[model samples]
Target: MIEASLPALNRRRFLWGAGAGAVTAAALLPGAARADGHAETVGAVMDGMVRDHNFQGVVALGRGGRIRTARAVGMAQIAQGIPMRTDTPLGIASISKRLTAVAVMRLVEQGALSLDARITTWLPDYRADVGARLTLRRLLSNSSGAPNPFRAAVAAEPALLQPPWIDTGEAVRRFATGDLVFEPGARFDYVLSNWILVLAIIETVTGQPYREAMRALVLDPLRMRHTTPVAPSEAMSYRTVSPPVEWINPRPPFLAAAGGYYSTAADLLRFAHGVYDTDFLSPTSRTALTTVEVASDSYALGGRMRTVAIGGAEVRAAWETGNTNGYRSVLGHRLDGRGAVVILNNNAISQRTMDAFAEALLRADAGVA
Candidate 1:
């Protein structure tokens, strides 16, 4: 449930370099008194969520590089009675897209890829007509007209949801290749095929498997030691909190670049710091990452960038959310250096409530009324 006191954010503007883009690491860190207050605010809201929604996972609020509040509520594996911990890794779902986008940008910075070039430059095997029209920027921004065939197919044949592992090339050919649902870059559609094709491009460009390329480009550099493309033995998702019926959501190798990965709250926070607080990305790439390309979706490259008004103060941030099976996650990183909010859950709850919770934490951390 959402906090009644916290006002819903009004996303009125898309401001780049207004928050995280201009701030230094030293300025983003909070003082001791502020950190204490932030912890109190987070704890109170988290306690309420656990009591009301049966939230089962970890929630962490951090500023600069230090964690102000990190709590684990409910159980990771209900059948085994394994309690959740702040370090417990949980499936991050589409948050993996943000990581994949970053990896692709790194390649662009290295002169290995171009954002405006037609996808066919790298994916010659793709359908010529469609590939010639789609570009890396359009795909990253979810403006690629790629149709979501997997969704319909999975609904008709549940078995198709998680088949045996397939290589990136095969996955792209079977699932990603499709007719354009709309003119490329004419509108927005959050299709999984875009990232699937992106995975194939990454593999072809780097001459490495998706996981290996991700490790070399992103995970290893960020020191996200606990994050992995392969699903780890961590939390077990539940459809219901009282009886805790298991929800099976498998992550095959081909889906790694889309919505397939497990991560801890701490590791996710580390990623926020690496991306926003440090010089991990080049200036051009960093700017490109947060520049709003799709205004209707509030999307930049792989994530949403918008201005949130909290307590009469407008805060610019990168808001990334994921929900699949019974797992849900949110990563809110304030570009203004106030901090970040990371929530990972095993039991499916209202996404609106989760988003509100994260925003409330941000408001409290910023001490905005």
Candidate 2:
């Protein structure tokens, strides 16, 4: 059975910085834990959130392969009164971007793809003028000029916003013919449509569906058995606003490659570690996959990488926050195998509170008082 309780833990190390790109390298370091206590100090804070009903999923922290703290609180299905278990699968939301990026990077390593190549190389029939100028690098970095379709689609065809009618190819075919917000690679402008094209590229090159490809390239090796494209009926996503009721989510196959997977906090912790592992990627490929292409952008392949201050020293870390409908989640991992924080909430809890809980764990692990 899934664990639903937080356990006491003893932390011995902490991470201080994220790897490459706009992040300063000097910030990466590992420090010994403080003598004040074990890493379980954040347990009380989490319990408070549960008591107040501010959260309804899982929170976990660990180093290497060992978990220091793990807890599940609130209802997975409030209507059914089914309590959320630590292993309960919850929508991971946009964190899927990181996974998609990794899948693309794996292809790049196999010589089947290239980062600097233009979209036309893969989707020769793309036929769009912008497609000629947009490169994989730009798409990976969110610097592509593609317009974000999430908001506009909701307005134009709110009813059609469901994933069935809006798969990746459909989204790409719609947006590729549309207009560009600015010149490709002009600067950072987040656009959901970029990844649709990415998913399209993946399919065109590999000739396999997103699910099959993702399983072979990422899920299998990482041992993330429970993470998969969400089926609205199998999961209950809550709304953060007034009514506070279960909200059904749609998973367009194409967008699923970007933000449609449902995963457990435990599985996400495994993914956090997967991003830093070179076992599946060569040294050169791993560097390309994780390094930032711009000096001002924190976005690496899919998530952001940056430096944080701790006890007057810098530490590098890679992290991402994802939300959809009523679910919000955060995964923060240090590169040196020193620390990581994974939290998933189902009630639209404040992201800051989650960050605080995670940072407290990092600090406690680092002996930073």
Q: Residue pairs in steric clash, candidate 1?
A: 19-335, 19-336, 20-335, 20-336
> Which candidate ranks first by TM-score, i.e. highest?
1
- Residue 62 displacement (Å), model 1: 0.7
**lDDT (10s digit) by residue, model 2, range 120-225:** 9998878658777888888888888787767776688776655356655667777545678888767887677778888889988889988889998899888888
lDDT of each: 0.79, 0.70
Ten-residue segment with the worst summed lDDT in candidate 2? 9-18
How close is every model to the real structure, measured as TM-score? 0.88, 0.84
Model 2 deviation from the true structure expressed as Cα RMSD, one decimal place: 8.2
Q: Give the TM-score of candidate 2.
A: 0.84
What are the per-model numbers of colliding residue pairs? 4, 11
lDDT of 1 at 126: 84
The positional error of residue 143 in candidate 1, measured at the CA in angstroms, is 0.9
Off by over 4 Å in 1: 1-37, 155-157
Error of 1 at 158 (Å): 3.9
State residue 205's C-alpha deviation in candidate 1, in Å: 0.4
